[model samples]
Target: MPRSPWWGRKVARLPERGTLIVSTDLQGNYEDYYALKQIYADEEERGNEPVLLLCGDLVHGPGEYFADPARWPDYLGTFYRDRSVDLVLDYAEWIDHAKTVALLGNHEHAHIGGPIVSKFHGDEAAVLDIRLGDDAPRVHDLFRSFPLIAVAPCGAVFTHGAPRATEPDLASFERIRYDGYARTAINDMYEEGTLGALLWARYAEPEHAQALLEAVHEGEGRHAFVAFGHDVVRSGYEKIGKEQICVSTSFGCEDRNKTYLRLDLGARYTSVDDLREGEEIRKLYPKA
Candidate 1:
């Protein structure tokens, strides 16, 4: 099936005035999902509407903890798929408020044979059977529509992984233009180890970060910053270069290890702070 025309746009512009964007990697953790809801609610209560951008990994793939024999069957059934859908529904308010933009993560790509295919082989079929089943087109559509990379109006880039470029330069990045075919382009970058394959990347060196910022600025014509979440950094957000920031929202199932990035977006300046050891929504919704 052809993808929606919306995904064809390479970069999306945020509100010109300013918008707070909450970027996080929710690896199918109910606690993190609920915490995100509270974050959005809290921001709304403060009279400041914010954009909630999910940096992918919304569903824990079979390559994750599902490898255990006890969890494989359930994961293949509806556990992961249902949770993925629930995450979207929980943030549906942003769909209208600030317009939530969910990027495609490596785990999300695993369902459609991205880099993780080598590890899960046949298990991918189980995911397809449930997510793309006759009655679940909506779930499949949601994943299909997710963009590989999202560029904010302020020139900030939000992606699930770091860009995959061999050379840390703006020229190399400019060559990687997103003219539709995003899935294929991302997969090719993953295969070639280029900076454009943000979903499959793990780390960005200082040079890579500099190159990415320049590329975004030159290609999009604005001062740009790149923020991504993939590799978990227990210490909180890390600055690879002056223009790049990495955050690990998942603390590996430990309550003490949780942290996320609070971004203050402005027409002139963009700032980010590490929010660590904060309140968990589980305290309020015991059943959730």
Candidate 2:
């Protein structure tokens, strides 16, 4: 059977007008977390408000180490719990998970604490922070099940990582659902040893990135814009083609600098920018 179109697919329903702030490849740097919070605050100060879209890697080091929550609950829970509390509900209005959206990166997928070699295996993956004899799901579960395709009413598709060129499809957001796993395997297949492992770490190159965009644009909605994080580009946002956009906010782990995206549906799906180097996002969308 033919798959449903990406545009107007409605994988998940969301508000028409809201800001999307996304970051990826964060190996759990404390400083980046602080900066991300500030970005959230700035967006709230701005009239459009915002949804924090984190592509993955919330904690530091390899993901295999995180499979056991009892082992690193402090590392994972501290960050996750703080965010849920630190923000005063009265400040920026939001619905359910509307305030935050997250997806698992290679690190989170690796189980965060397993044997070093297992890090490259997908099926070996496990959720984080749930094994402490707890009754509820933990942070890892949230990222694992994140919708592969996030379609904004404005017609934008957001994914954690970009797809590879062999994909060769455009104009469909649904492709992201299956392609995401392939992208993860490719990350694990960089080479025979450690060097290849390191090379596969970042998300870049044009071919794969473009294929994913084309798939999403198939939706044929208002704007077929594709937003994503992963693969730190010194240049930041990249226009792979007329209908695709890639943005990275993890300006490296040590650098205090951070970048996030913002979108306004009412504006004909035309405006998109990176907020970094301490610039206030409120300038474009004033706080209501």
- Predicted model with the maximum lDDT: 1
Against the true structure, what is every candidate's RMSD? 6.7, 9.4
Runs of candidate 2 with Cα error greater than 4 angstroms are: 1-14, 45-47, 62-98, 112-137, 165-223, 251-257, 270-288
> What is the C-alpha lDDT profile of model 1 across 92-154, one tens digit per residue?
434544445677766665554453333344444355446445634555455656666665566
* Candidate lDDT (C-alpha), each: 0.53, 0.43
Q: Cα miss at 99, model 1 (Å)?
A: 2.3
TM-score of 1: 0.67
Cand. 2 TM to true fold: 0.54
